[model samples]
Target: MRVSGLILPWAFLLATALFAVGLYWALWVAPPDFRQGDGARIMFVHVPAAALSIGVYAVMAAASVTALIWRHPVSDLTAKSCAPVGAAFTLIALITGSIWGKPMWGAWWVWDARLTAELILLFFYLGYMALWNAVEDQTTAARAAAILCCVGSVSALLSKYSVNFWNTLHQPASLSVDKAEHVHDAFYLPLLVMMGAFYAYFMAFLLLGVRKEIRARRIRNLRGALAREAGA
Candidate 1:
């Protein structure tokens, strides 16, 4: 755990550097879309935000499984810490998509399947966080939250496939490793860089959040023990 103390600072610095350069490359270095023009610039942010929102949930679901099966002390904390970050990225995805949509789709939002499913994903995040805090008992709360996280994890798959399942205002994925990338090199390169930066940011912050939760738990236990001793 002491290694985490040393690791977080360097991780934060690396994330910052990557983001700074990635954003610059995305905005300035990458050429605009041949069709959408500068409006396509929003893709650099929207795609990563959307991906990480589901990606973080995937991490949470894995932690949830560990917490349920192995009963690891930190698993619940890891899952709990991920909700807000996932929610924030979900929000960024929604808002950026809306902004990009206004220019392309002539509207800020539509009731299309992918958009609707993403909205549902937001509720799942909010619900998960609320569920954890609403309970007073830590152990009970963690178990409850873990179950909810596991069940709701399906929404991530639904969100990802929604675009593929229906013909909607949203377009299909532009990049795929198995298939030829739809984007040109000018745009694809920067998008790849940005995605890497976004993932780095998530990992760095996630570790920091988990570390804070661990510290907070220890402090609470210490204070409770002191009170019990004084009473005795």
Candidate 2:
């Protein structure tokens, strides 16, 4: 808690700085694409949100695995905290993708493989959170949620690889480590900065959420102890 408290402010500051620079570069500094014109600028926000939507789920799934297998003290809390944030990112990705698609694809949406898979991923996130809320017992809820997270991880895999496995209107990755030349530096650098900002925002939000969960659990435990003493 102490370490997280100290680090949280810096994380927010870093995210803020990166977001300011990234948005400036993406919106103003980067040249309009010859092909898509200014419509392509939306990719700067859309791409990062799309990537993080899956990436955050991966983090939750890993934490869920640890919570289930090793019973790590903070693992379940970490996974629980990740769900809402991941869901928000998924929603952003969907909305932004739709916005970008309408102009480029000439429709608001299509049943593209990647888009369908991403929608399923959003459902998984909602189900995971719903399970946590439905169960009364914390331990039982944690176990059930962890299992769901693991099972739903298949959606994340599908979301990532659907473009590769099937024909789709959605384009391939805008940036790749091996194929750096595919995107011009003007666009690529700003995209990278935006991704960094999103990641930093995730970390800051995750820490804040986990801390809140820990405090809530402590309060519940204390109240339980008080009730037991009164009954005795």
Candidate 3:
């Protein structure tokens, strides 16, 4: 393999361990929210998922750029590999956000900036996948999808900042990028664990998906070569 194969398995193991630690801290060690009580526990997963959705989108964008710039087959495969995972993360974020909203905001859905932008992102993902399927040629499909991926990345950025750019039902960022706070070390430690777990999950899935795509491509090449030899 051109990539670090060992890293994926190690990442999977590390992620599992982190997830276990995070769950323990969130459920047992960290104190419940003064306001939301036990319900606040949901944030442990929701926030991480939401953040990851955006982060993965950024990765997809970078991969798309590489695919177009370097014309690297692996880059295209990696970009294509990320779509489903990104979509899954986005779905998880939306569902958890809705659930959190119902208890906190008294509504299941809203046309707020963040929510609207996120929904648009979901559509963009679907559209990009559809475009890939519509094209018959792999090169053509990769180019088209790369464009769509790059263009669609705008929505991903907007999704992250929508809460701040406009008034929205979604809460602002949990940990400020600008300022630091004395978050209870217990809570911070677990938050790190969960974040690491989520990242590992992304890597595990992305690597597996790319590996499958590479295998299929190799098979196609072999079949084409055999057919050519027979014809000759």
Candidate 4:
């Protein structure tokens, strides 16, 4: 718990530093894309959000598994905390991807493998949230929602491989062997910094959400205790 307590403040500091460096690199240093021109700046946010959206789901799913296997309350709360944040990130990815695509691809939307699978991933997050809220019993909610999370992981996997599996407007992997240095040095550095910032942001938010949930639980317990005392 002591180690975990340190994560919040450190995450906040890390996020700030990364975001500052990343913005400088992305906006000032990176040259305009020959093809996309200034519009390609969208990649910094779009790629990181898209990548982290998938990663957050993985975290939720893993926490769900731990909750069920170890019967840990903190694990359940952490899983619950992650779902909404993951959903928000997924939405950001979709929106930014559309914005990035319109001028470049000449279309705002496409039913390609990557897009479709990512859409499905969003729905999965929503469904998990709904399931958790629908149940009145905490234990039952955690167990049932955990199962959904595990099942929905299939789509997450599909999302990762979708570009490879099918011809899509979305470009191939950023780190492909064929295109080791596809992006300019200036852009690459900032993009990496942005990615680090996004990760730190995710951690900070995760811990914040967990703390809020814990406090809510504590308040509920106190309320229950007061009611018992009043009855006595």
**Model 4 lDDT tens row, 1-232:** 4666788899999999999989888888788988889998999998889988899999998999999899888999999999988999899999999999899889999998898899999999999999988998777988999999999999988988888788887897664335464566667667778989999998998899999888888897898899999999
**How many clashes in each candidate?**
0, 0, 0, 0
Q: For model 4, what is the error of residue 57's alpha carbon versus the real structure, in angstroms, after optimal superposition?
A: 0.8
Is 2 or 4 the stronger prediction by TM-score?
Answer: 2
Writing each residue's lDDT as its tens digit, candidate 1 over 142-208 gives: 9999999988887899899888888887898867885474677787778888888888888888888
TM-score per prediction, in order, is 0.96, 0.98, 0.93, 0.92
Q: lDDT values of the candidates? A: 0.89, 0.94, 0.84, 0.88
Q: Estimate, for each residue in 114-134, the C-alpha lDDT of model 3 and write its tens digit.
A: 998888888887887788789
Residue 97 CA displacement from its true place in model 2, Å: 0.3
**Can you give the lDDT of residue 192 in candidate 3?**
69
TM-score: the better of candidates 1 and 3? 1
RMSD list, candidates in order: 1.1, 0.9, 1.8, 1.9
Give Cα distance to truth, residue 77, candidate 3, Å. 0.8
What lDDT score is found at residue 93 in candidate 2? 94
TM-score of 1: 0.96
The runs of at least 3 residues in candidate 1 whose Cα sits more than 4 Å from the true structure, single-residue gaps closed, are none
Candidate 4 stretches with Cα past 4 Å from truth are 1-5, 176-182
lDDT of 2: 0.94
